[model samples]
Target: MKKYLGPILFFAVFEAVAVTLWLTMDHLFYLFNFTYIGGSVALGLVLYIRKWKYARLMVQLAVGLYMLIYLGILSRENMQIEGFWYYLFLGVFEAATIHYVVAKIAGPLLFGRGWCGYACWTAMILDLLPYKTPCGPRRKLGYIRYITFGISLLFVGGLFLLHVPDLEKVMFWSFFIGNALYYGVGIALACAFKDNRAFCKYICPITVFLKPASYFSLSRVKNDTEKCVSCGKCKTVCPMDVDMTDNARRRKNGTECILCLKCVEACPKHSLHI
Candidate 1:
């Protein structure tokens, strides 16, 4: 029962969001969207608890492909950061706006960067690259994320400032091209850095929102010292370079944790848990 609590809580949270949005916005899509995502995540959690190796990747694809293909392409809703800005400026409280509020922005306060680990379409493809672990020390280039974030804001702002005609079409095209650019750069950086998460660590504009809210995340990996032998396997396997051994909020790369559970899997002493 205790072990199942994590999945139950996550499903409940997402369901609450689903019901609220469905009732308030008068859209059944919200109910369907969040329910599917929540169920996928809950299933993944159950698989992880059962020691399934590809549990995280399974969730990543189930959610990521659904968003990228069904919502973004078929339904023509831009779920990207640029789309969030586009919808926000139009004072439209649907689609990307609601998505950002629930997933990337305020949602991080509860789940940390779990979205990055289990549901980013960009990262879903990037994670398939050969470099599962970083080859060298983390670089000082994380400042690049801020630059990218600013660029996204300015790009959308420029379109509105210029009063571009046929704005919806342009936004849809931007969503298409922007995802292409992300995949191109993300793959190149991953191969260059020998790190699967290089783009996530240094270039993802969403991190600007995810990091601050995630700093106070209620769900986090913790190390139990009483059960511990100081084997450094956890650190070696952590994709985000988090020091999960330290339970403090200010631990090294603490906000960067995506809750991927590689650290937990690698802990021979079984001292790590959420």
Candidate 2:
């Protein structure tokens, strides 16, 4: 019962904020966007400090589902903005700037990729996905984010350098189908790969963008090697399949980390610190 208190309190706070935003704002869908990222971060902070698993999971589901509905299925107005060249430039610039600032402040100063664990909308959805993925003994899969990052960069750059006047027409038609496919494929992959956050770990372009930015984030997951019993709970609970123990042991920071704080909460011996 004590374990459930923190989550319940956090959920109440999150819902209150959402209702306030909805009542006050003209564009309620925008609130959905803000809630997914902003609310997740706030909840993650509470969970990190309080070590509440249920609260973390609750925030994960609420924020993740809202994002899917808003960004993926409900409307294409947001994606429509991408059709304009200036809007596209500004959007990518703003996104990159936010990613860089948040990552730098969170990664080095406070916790490594802690932002990814809590703040990323993509990670939020991946967290709610119920399945387990195979954790291979090797660390080769960690490089997938780097490849994704490169591809996103190329896509953004191609849009800027190549003057494609018909891009918007193409995008307008593609948006609905593309988003549906994306969500469908992501959910299917989650069902297939039970252990890891299949979509977040291997496919999300947003994660690719956030990885470099997270390097500069203020917070990070820290480990107390001495207290660690090597139970591997942190790794088991990790949606991204990151070996928190290995990461803690090496003190090596990577862009793949979402900073959801699951590893911190999962450490039975309190070996994982954030």
Candidate 3:
């Protein structure tokens, strides 16, 4: 029962969100959507606790494909940063805005970057690449994310400011093109840097929102120094170069942790946990 507590708690939190939105918004889609995503995530956590190796990948595919193909492509909901800006300018509080708030913004205060590890459509594919861990020291190109963030905001703001015609159609097409660019750039950067998360480290504009809230994340990995041999295995396996042993809010790259648990698995002394 204790072992299953994490999954139960996760499911309960999402269920509360699902029910609240469904009733308040009077939309059955919210009920179905959040429930499915929550169920898949809970199932994955259960599998992970059971030592199933592919549990994370399974959840990523389930949530990523649903959001990317079903919601983005077929249903025509753009769930990207551009889409968030597009809807924000239009004063629409549904769809992409709601998603960003839940998954990337406020939600990180509770779960950190769990969405990056488990549900991001972009990272879903990137994680399948050759480099599960970084090959070298982190680069100083982090400033790129701020630039990309500005570009996305400006692009959408430009459209509204200029009163672009057929704005709905434009947004739809932008979603397609933006995802293509992300996938292309993400894959290329991964191969070039020998790091599967290179794109996430330097290019993803959503991190502009994810990082700040996650800095105060209630859920985080901690290391027990008494049990730790200081062999440096946790840092070696961390995809984001997070210093898990530090147990400080300002630990090196602390905001970059995606809760992937790779470091936890690599810890030889069983000193790391969330």
If the candidates were sorted by their TM-score against the true structure, best first, what order would they fall in? 3, 1, 2
**Model 3 lDDT, residue 5, Cα:** 90
Clashes, model 2:
32
- Over the stretch 1-274, how does candidate 2's per-residue lDDT look in tens digits? 5654544554554455456656665447534654556556565556645655576556556655554456434543333112223344656433224224434333334445544454444556555665643444333454665665465456546865887666545455554554565567677866665534666666655555455545554445667889988887787666565566764433333455666666776788988764
How many clashes does the backbone of model 3 have? Answer: 0
Error of 1 at 148 (Å): 0.5
For model 1, residues 70-180, the per-residue Cα lDDT tens digits are 999999999999999999999999889988988889999999999999999999999999999999999999999999999999999999999999988998999899999
Candidate 2 wrong stretches, greater than 4 Å: 1-40, 47-52, 65-116, 119-125, 132-175, 246-253
lDDT of 3: 0.95
Cα TM-score of candidate 3: 0.99
Model number with the top TM-score: 3
Q: TM-score, each model?
A: 0.98, 0.60, 0.99
lDDT-best of 1 and 2: 1
Q: Candidate 2 — worst ten consecutive residues by lDDT sum?
A: 77-86
| Model 3 misplaced regions, further than 4 Å | none
Q: lDDT per model, in order?
A: 0.94, 0.53, 0.95
Distance from true position, residue 148, model 3, in Å? 0.6
